[model samples]
Target: MKYIIGLAGIVLVFLLAFVASSDRKRIRYRPLIVMIVLQAILAFVLLNTGVGSFLIGGFASTFEHLLSYAAEGVNFVFGGLANVNEAPFFLNVLLPIVFISALIGILQYIKVLPFIIKYIGLVLSKVNGMGKLESFNAVASAILGQSEVFISVKKQLGAMPRHRLYTLCASAMSTVSMSIVGAYMELIKPEYVVTALVLNLFGGFIIASIINPYEVDPKEDILEIQEEEKQSFFEMLGEYIMDGFKVATTVAAMLIGFVALIAMINGIFSGIFGISFQDLLGYIFAPFAFLMGIPWGDAVQAGSIMATKMVSNEFVAMTTLTNATGLSARAIGIVSVFLVSFANFSSIGIIAGAVKGLHSKQGNEVARFGLKLLYGATLVSVLSATIAGLFM
Candidate 1:
């Protein structure tokens, strides 16, 4: 029964992607079929197998240790703000990003990260039937982040055509930055976070191939990563440390604003319509939730949380998911997988602005296709979650 629903969910996702395809005739099925099979196998291994459990456990434990180390720094700076048992979200969750970001900088400085991103991307390009640059951007986006990933490829920013640029941005929105992975694990199950990260990587390509099909001319598929200006080790370390803090504070600010606004809107809707705004959104998104193998009884609540991620951001939705009651564990797992990407409305502007800062004309091109970009990215999340639902 679960298999039937999961297969139907896959069909529904593909059909939706097919309907929006810019060039349905040009869509390649061979690579898509290969990737879909890969997604399922990977999902099964990650969710059900012993080796998968060991890997996820190690990954989660490593992040846990990293967060503990980060907490020492937080304690030194703001020791008395909260008791050990009652740490604030900003301190407990957001500040650890600073440490992880610094670690990424160290890896970047030593060139290890670039080496890994490059070779893995080369291997993925062979399977995904895309250009080296697109595959690199997808991998780099997962590690470096959406905005920072563009800086790595800034040399080709101006030269990329609209279709290729859409693919680039789609990958950025489909995957989460590694810096925030620990933060997400804190809000949901660590295993689900790991599963979503792997699934979304391939899912990004699968949906992009369908919705924005095009051939990459090998001659034009050159990948020239923009090298960062050389800085002394301490100089680089300080810079990353500050960058991490800025990200932490920025997320904290968004949480404050988005959470309050949602509360206000929910209040107004409840006052007038006897239904909270999220409940209204739940009704609209419930079918997608149901189609993703969430049981019909749980779909409405699951859909509301999914809608929250799309409209506000994943943090807000994850927080809601944590507080939500009456959802079965399976429903929670499926929804947790669904909320792991940067597929919200705000990301369109972020990706566009990131490109615009690099090259004005190319940024404008990103903005023009911004909605389509989000559409493809959201489908990527749905496809990944549906694939995950099969094994769960």
Candidate 2:
């Protein structure tokens, strides 16, 4: 009954969104419909199959142990606060963001990440018709943020076609920042992180390809990334650590400011509704969370996180999701995937601001493509959840 409602609602939402779309000619339902069907199959396996149920048990346990390993990292970094009974908010939460940024830098220096990029680029090239460098940067951005990943491909950005440039921005918006990956790994599941990486990589390729489908040239992108031109392994790793520090600081600052702003806005809404802002968030997004396979008992609480994520940032949502009580592990998995991207309203301004700042010449062009990117990211995240939900 629940999944029935979810499927119906998803169909309705898609149809309604489609109707509202002024450019009906460009709507290609192929990927969208395929994703929907996949979501249904996923829901069925989770709900009905004993095999699926057992598999979830394995994944859930493995996820628990993986989190424990991550917790060790947290504990090592912040000793006394490591007590499981009372996790330190700053050490466990903020510091992990700092740590993962450093780790990404470390991985990149070791050339471990480059190999991953090569394989990822190959897959994207074959699957989505993207060039090797474009796909490499997209995959790298999964491990690096917008500015940092740009470093990996800084030279290429200036010369890339307008369509590819937009794709880069869109992919950045659609994926998680590497700095927070460790925290999210502990919050959700290792399998979940791995799955998101896979989906983000796939989504970057597929969605970008859909937005800019020109097979006109088979040549590699004119822009070449030059991360290895001057630095040796140790030097590069140090640079990555420094880069991570810069990124972590920037993100921490953004989160602090953004969180305060959200509280202020929610407070304004709170006065109108005569309920606390959190309560209002819980009231509204609960139904959608319910459709995404969150247990009814935890739906409202989990919905609050989802709503916060949609309105503000996924980091806050993940923080709320990790901290929220009275939720089943399966439900957590579902919500984690649902909250796994830059889908909220805040991202609109972020993209608009960033794109406009850099591409002032095509600022209007950037604005024109903004909503499509948003819609595409939303579809990708939700569709990834549905695929992952089946595994749950």
Candidate 3:
């Protein structure tokens, strides 16, 4: 029965995209069907089978080890402040991103990450029936982040058409950066994060191909990275360390502000309406949650988390999920997968600003289509969660 609902959710998602499609007639059903079928299969393999159990166990343990290693840096700086007795989420969970970012930088400096993203992206492009750049952005965005991936393709930003540009930005918005994957693992099951990452990679393309259909000229489907002047090995490491710290501080600041503000807003709404703002939103989003295979009884609570992810960010939503009670395992699984993307309201500014910093006119165009990007990316998240729901 849950699988049936999940299947219906998938169809509804594509129909929603198709109805709002910029060029409905040009929507490629072949790639869309292939991607959805692939997502379903991948979700099953990752969640229900023995191979998935072994893979997820290794992934969780590996991330756990990395989190332990990251704790070393946290211990060195704050010492007893981050001691296990009373370590806060910011210090223990979020700050580890600094270490992860440093590791990513090391991987990038050695050219290991770029080579992998390029070729993996090349293969994905062939399967997804999109341009090489669009496919590369999806994988790169998963690793490098939404904003930073643009720098990797900065050379081509100016020349790419609007439709292709939308595809790139959509992929970025739909996927989460690896820097925070540990933090997510701390809050939710690692399998959901891992599965969501893979599903959203394809889900982003499926929705984008429908909503923003266009043909990439084979002659212009470039996969070249923009080269930068070489810095000494130590210089690069130091730079990455600083960059990691910046990312950590940025997330910490956002969490403090957003979480506190949400608390205050919920207070006001509760005072006046006899219900919290999130509860009201939950009621509003409950139907969508139900369609995603959440039991009707749990739909309101699940929808609240979903709405929270869109309004604030996934971190805040995941925090809520971690502390939540009365939800079934299936509801938790679907909600956890849903909160894995960077598809919130604030990302509009972040993505557009990132592009604007590189190219002004194109950034303005992205800004104009900002809401559409959010709509499409949010659908990508829903699609992934729905598919994961079937197997869970």
lDDT of 3 by residue, 1-392 (tens): 88778888988998899987999878878988888889989999999999988998998998899989999888898887644678588888888988888898889999999999999999999899999989989999999999999998999999888898999999999999988899899889999999999899999999999999987889988787986568888888888778878888888888899999999999999999999999999999998999999999999999999999999989889989998999999899999999999999999999999999999999999999999999999999999999999888
Against the true structure, whose TM-score is highest? 1
Cα deviation of 199 in candidate 2 (Å)? 2.9
Cα error, residue 350 of model 2, in Å, equals 5.5
User: What tens-digit string does per-residue lDDT give for candidate 2 at 290-364?
Assistant: 766667788788778877887677777787777787788877877787777776666766666655565554445
Cα lDDT over the full model 1: 0.94
Residue 206 error, candidate 2, Å: 4.8
lDDT score, candidate 3, position 307: 99
Q: How do all the candidates rank in terms of TM-score, highest first?
A: 1, 3, 2
Q: For model 1, how does the per-residue alpha-carbon lDDT over 1-392 read when each residue is reduced to its tens digit?
A: 87888888889888888999999999999999999989999999999999999999999999999999988998899899887678589989999999999999999999999999999999999999999999999999999998999999999988888899999999999999999999999999999999999999999999999999999988898989899999999999999999999899989999999999999999999999999999999999999899898999999999999999999999999999999999999999999999999999999999999999999999999999999999989999999999899999
Identify the runs in model 2 with alpha carbons over 4 angstroms from their true place. Answer: 1-6, 9-85, 129-134, 204-216, 219-223, 281-287, 294-300, 326-330, 345-372
- After TM-score superposition, what is the CA distance of residue 192 in candidate 2 from its true location, in Å? 3.1
TM-score of 3: 0.98
**lDDT computed for candidate 2:** 0.64
* Candidate 2 TM-score to native: 0.74
Evaluated against the true structure, the overall lDDT of model 3 is 0.91
Give the CA lDDT, 0 to 100, for residue 152 in model 2.
Answer: 66
